[model samples]
Target chain A: MTKKKQPEPAETGATEHQLWEVFTQPGGGKPFEHAGSVHAPDAEMALQNARDVYARRGEAVNLWVVPSSAIVASTPEDIGPFFDPGNDKPYRHPQFYKVPRGIKV
Target chain B: MLGHRLSEWCGHGPILEEDIALTNIALDLVGEANLLLGRAATAENAGRDADALAFLRDVREYRNALIVELPKGDFGFTVARQFLFSVYALHQWEALSTSADDDLAGIAAKALKETRYHVRHSAEWLVRLGDGTDESHGRVQDALDELWRFTGELFLTDDVEQALVKQKLAVDSSSLFDAWKRDVTDVISRATLRMPGDVYMQRGGRSGMHTEHLGVMLAEMQVLPRTYPGAKW
Candidate 1:
């Protein structure tokens, strides 16, 4: 199978600093969505950078900026084994439980 | 004046999405103004709540940045104002998020997100209009020229900002000017729009001074409350 393309890292020989991941909640009741990334001098500047980059259309109510360096991401190769055990736990499946008629999932 | 003008679109935007978007930004700005004005009221011992400070106050009592009061000439102008202000606000909120005042910092932390989208939406439109048809380009450029005069007021610092800066409750507004310019210019240039050249800058939004438009806006916005006198929706 063809491998999924990965996001490229920051280019080398660039004078500007690193990128920051910006997550946002559209409103108080919404979950945060990864809006996009921005580059800036530091965490404080990163938040500003992300604000300048992401939240333009009433699409966010909250913002969280984490340095690209601070994040610990799992690679695709690690996903199968790391998540495999839980897949075989049939008891964890909702299908085993009986539901009342007309009940929605 | 701009906030009120934009707020006029509260229930009247062309589409629901645009409606929500415009109102949301208006509320964000009005909310921010409320906070600042409330603080100013307290400092001045004006004995007014935020609503009173916002609705009951006359034009001469408002201290909003002039850029926030200018008429929203058209969608392009509105977007231009939103674009510039959002960039400025994003930087302001980011800095304020770490302010010494916990309340102010917390508010900033929350507001930064809203302001972020305001910037993005405006920027997106700026790109579309700037790089779209010749008519679109021309009007957007016209909007920029008309709006540029008010921008200087955004970065102008006075006693309040100075005192707040000393108290660590505010950012030095001037410090963000370069970033604001770079951010706005980059977007304008990419959109193929010309930035207005050396122009006479309008001042006086921060000293309870205002444009004639504010009186009319306040009249309409405050009429319901003034007429009903405590009637609830």
Candidate 2:
């Protein structure tokens, strides 16, 4: 098990401040999409940074910022087993099914 | 002039995010100035447009406060100035949003939204800088102290504005002081900085009197237009 990384104390003057992963919503009840990352001392600053960095030019109607350390990403070593595809299953694809004329995707 | 000062941070901010943030603010201010200038031109009833008024103005003719005309000292200074000015501007806009005049009210209503965001951004920076480290705290506190005197000018109601205020055409600048002070005190206390008390307030920017810096800035800002009148791309 990977150890959960702790965020640094903001006022201690860390060399590299905490990294925040940015997600932005494009409005109209759309899901938030990963935009980019920004460096900030804490959550409030992270949100402001995300607004300045990612929300310009009408790119976002909403923004979300998460500490990069809080995210647990899979390693390349686990690629084979974690997302293994034992065989091609053509029937599992939604496109394989034929629908009546009145049906819509 | 504040917009001009903010524009200096276009490529010179400490971080990429700040660079964009400052420049975005600069653009917003400049746009606001453009609209205000257009409104002024119509009010003047002269044949001048916004460009004419901006490019043709002399040093003493420009009625902007001294704080904005001062050079962009440092990031701390810029943030401090933004906080002070944005707060005042926000209140002014809020009051003016309901003015009897349709044009001024419409402009103020739109500007209120932008000013609100500007206040939020600057206030956030003020807290971070004032509480972050010993060096940052010292610098930002110094900035706040230096900017404190200039804030009085924001509440000064000139004769023209007072007359307009009577007719409900302009906001009563003096009336906004208490609310502005309360908000400023709250933010300063939260930032853990002492608010400088009762310094000699600077004044006289509204009557066409300004600092020496405005001339140099105007020279730079108006050179092209002055040289080639009616020149266009």
> Per-residue lDDT tens digits of candidate 1, residues A1-105?
112233233444555557778999989988888887776545655664565457755577789998878889889998899989888898898887899899987
Q: What's model 2's lDDT at A82? A: 75
| Model 2 chain B weakest lDDT span, ten residues long | B129-138
Query: What digit string (tens of lDDT, one per residue) describes model 2 on residues B91-197?
Result: 99999899998988998999998899899999999988887767778888899899888889888887899899889999878899999999999998888888898
Q: For each model, chain A TM-score?
A: 0.71, 0.72
**Structural similarity to truth (TM-score) of each candidate:** 0.67, 0.91
Off by over 4 Å in 2: A1-14, A76-79, A84-87, A96-105
Give the Å error, residue B53, model 2.
Answer: 1.7
Clashes in model 1: which pairs? A55-B116, A55-B117, A56-B117, A56-B118, A56-B120, A56-B121, A57-B117, B1-B69, B2-B68, B2-B69
Question: Residue A84 lDDT in model 2?
Answer: 67
